[model samples]
Target: MGKWTNLIKQTTDSDPISGAVNTPIQLSSTFSQADFDTYGHFDYSRSGNPTRESGERTLASLEGGKYGYLFSTGMAAISSVLFIFSSGDHLVVSKQVYGGTFRILHDVLPRFGITYDLVDFSNIEEIKKAIKPNTKALYIETPANPTLNITDISAVVALAKEQGLLTIADNTFMTPLTQRPLELGVDIVVHSATKFLAGHSDILAGVAVTNDDELAKRIYFIQNAVGATLGVTDTWLLLRGLKTLGVRYKRSSESAQTIAEHLQADKRVVQVLYPGLSSHKGYDIHQRQASSGGAVLSFDVGSLENARKVVEHLEIPIFSVSLGAVESIISYPPKMSHAELNSEELLEVGITPGLLRLSVGLEDVEDLIDDLDQALSYID
Candidate 1:
């Protein structure tokens, strides 16, 4: 928005000619600085683009961050944060996080001689006990990945601040509208724009926002050096997707609450893991920190065989690995998302073969329920 609030109102609104302010796919790789300004800036697409810059500024404004950088994918944005660390440094992360993030922390970072601890952040004592002298950052995902366990944001932020450790939070599921970790004592906030942030499944992208100037400089250097920035078209798509995020999330969450309630009473369901449900383990903590419970929920059939049958027969919820889309989706965490986790670890996190994670979409609740009901009949 050119560091101006008035720019935001104009840029976000539809272009007067076609009702879309963002240009249609600005793909020009290089720009002539002399034509615009005497000093050189954003000379190449690899370094920057007007379309991408617009999206970055929009996101940063939403998250109350001074800067935002778009990336090729969520993992890329997350990995860029690791640029702050090096060999001998340690990272403290939550055990119940996205499988991709878990693997990066446990498998890839170790190769660089960086150590990590997968701790139960729900219990602040666990985090305190696990901290080592080398701990550089405390990485956390509240309403943590599959399990839906939540860590108290204020407590974690307080402890991290006291320990002189950088605080990093994954706000993919919540988006900035629901949760602003940056305002809650966090140093950096990251998002998988592929998910809720984009509000549509059309693009695969990631974004990072922060208030720290030095951290922004380091991340900018990392993106330039590593060269994993999102394309101009993708950035435009993400921005377009972001425009309707508020609506999509609200509708999806409404459907999810209905589905969670419908499933919780089913005899075939062993558990319905949704933060929106008052019975959920993280319901209180999530409510305290977030404006609304998210749309994704996980529930387990009585057995592994039953889970397979349900997914196979579902007519409404698409069977897939990814989440945060317009269509309802079902996934088996064990074989799908978290396959890399050993059997023991999978069981420990309650990600049995029977565990089916449902990503609620903006669909008719009755239609979704009917489809799910018919699928459950196939399980028996």
Candidate 2:
């Protein structure tokens, strides 16, 4: 089947008992045991739910993985994956990861004795130097947040394989529709489904998918043990959102390309960070691995004052935190997404005060360009 056909088919499932076209949400907190020794598939909601199971199966199929798990939030899903490693394990991670991810690694994980080294994933040598005898995994976010720096997924996975390390990728930016990391040799793929998979700004959800049977068992055990599973309602909503991901992302990516090109030509813009742009540092490599340049792009206007001016004058895109919605969103990395990092830390990772990340949506490309032009006009 074609990707579009598979996308809709895999995401949509019917309720067997109700004869309904949509998967019915099972709201029961617990189910009765069929016999003394044999319990139903879902004995408790924390461990599993019918709606969540269906959603997970769909997610796994979409990502070309064998197993999938849903979580309460994106961070929860990531943290659960990290928890799979033992206390003494070390990890090599991309430096410019999401703020929440940095927060967990910088603050939360240390207490548990797990250590990590933040390295520039664009440079494979840096990743190589960061690995220690205790290193257990290489975690990355391609088209990395705020900067839109692309990492060669296959290159990184190859390195991980040679070193006997697990490779985990955060596919929130691309989603499974654009890039299936597992197919490219990634051991596990994670997403903050709240951003793209849900397609609406209403719910918070997360997903983790893996093809390895042993890894799947470990992830499932953590998901069940931590009790941070998605609710039945959100699971059903996520499924609904997934059905339209193909069309939504297509429109969003197209708009983003036009916007990125427009920003690149504008004199007020110091730099445009988008894989769709031919001049982007990772353009050639990105083209090799992913089908689209994705919907998010970032740009710098030279200073914090100029950034404030542009953001304040913006009319169309809402000045908000999250991305990947029907509505366009503009985010300031220093404050909105990477607030946990200090000024020095942010700059070190190339997240400048002047940087603005835009998550393009299903809007008229010309209108979005004009709105951005009007806002950027205030910078001078």
Candidate 3:
């Protein structure tokens, strides 16, 4: 059998007699085996579970990887990958990334003597300039958070290989459906299943898919050692979320595109930042790398005061922190997602108080626009 098929088959979960796939959650903390091996190698839930294995295996196929590992959250996957590098090793990352990741790079990892350089990945030269002799990895997010900037994964991967550095892509925003970074040459692909993969704000999980068996084993070691494996209930929740991902993307992406166009036309808005925009800086590159424009978009409303006004006044769309849910929601990254950042730090990544990010849902386009139109008046 092909490697992909084999991985799928081995990792798949099924009812012993029923033959039902995507088997029910296995909550047992320990499994019994014969010959005093009561807890077979897979004895504990933290080391592995059927539900989690199925989810990881499914993601492995979707991302075109030989193996997949599920984590307690997306950050866990990223943190673990970064762990491979020792103290004093340098890492280069994009300037505009998910708030939580930014915090980890800027605030936490440095404590362990792991220094990182935040650069404008949109410019290959800038990234090249930032790469130090001690650089161990190039961590980036395409269609970056809040700003939606795109990075050329193939080019970056080639660059990393030439430098003998590892490459990791945060594939959460694109999901495997839109962009398979691994296929484009990324060594590792990370996802915050909490968003697109889960398609609901119900579960918090993360996963890393890789083609390298040794690397996978190393990551597995850390995952098991760290004991951040996904819980049974959350794994089931993620499984349920995956069932409708295609349908969810279909409706939500359309709504997001229409809203982005409408926002571009509105005089009150300074600019619209969606990959769907023809004039967007990375729109072309994004199309080449991603399957769709994605369901999330961000825009500027002139000033922080105006931004606050629109978010606080939205009537139909719910204002919340997360981006990919069944209900339309808006987020103020500087306040909601990046509240941890200091004033200067937030501004460094272009996350100004006036910037408003939107996670479009399956709602009707007219209502979303109407809600925004009415909310615009509240800005003044």
Best-fitting candidate, measured by TM-score? 2
Please write out the lDDT profile of model 2 over residues 1-380, one tens digit for every residue: 99889988887687777778888988899999989999777888999888899999999999999999999999999999999988999999999799999999999999999999999999999999999999999998998998888899999999999999999999999998889899999999999999989989989999999999999999999999999999989998998988899999999999999889989999999999999889998999999989999999999999999999998999999999999998999999999899999999999999988999999988898999999988988876
- Pairs in steric clash, model 1: 14-19, 14-20, 15-19, 15-20, 15-21
Worst 10 residues of 2 by lDDT: 10-19
Question: Model 1 scores what on Cα lDDT?
Answer: 0.84
**Which is better, 1 or 2, measured by lDDT?**
2
The RMSD of every model to the true structure, in order and in angstroms, is 3.2, 0.8, 2.9
Give the candidate number with the greatest lDDT: 2
Q: After superposition, how far is residue 249 of candidate 2 from its true place, in Å?
A: 0.3
lDDT of 1 by residue, 1-380 (tens): 42234334523745556776565566788877775447576788878877778788878888879999999999999988876688999988888888988888878988999999888888899998888999988988977777777878889999998999889999888888788899998999999999987766788898999999999998888988898999988887787777677778888988988999999999889898888899987788899889878888899897789998898788888888888999888888888778889999988766776788998998898999999888887866
The sequence of per-residue lDDT tens digits that candidate 3 reaches over residues 1-380 is 64334434544467787787766787898877767635465677888887778788887887899999999988898888777777899999998888888778888889999999999888888889999999999998988888888888888988899889889999887777778898888989998888877877888899999999888998999898998888888888887777677778878988889999998998888889999889899988888888789899999998888987897789777788777888888988888888877899888887766899999888888989998999997766
Best-to-worst ranking by TM-score = 2, 3, 1
Q: Candidate 2, which segments miss by more than 4 Å at Cα? A: none
RMSD of 1: 3.2
- Relative to the true structure, candidate 3 reaches a TM of 0.94
Please give the clash total of every predicted structure, in order.
5, 0, 0
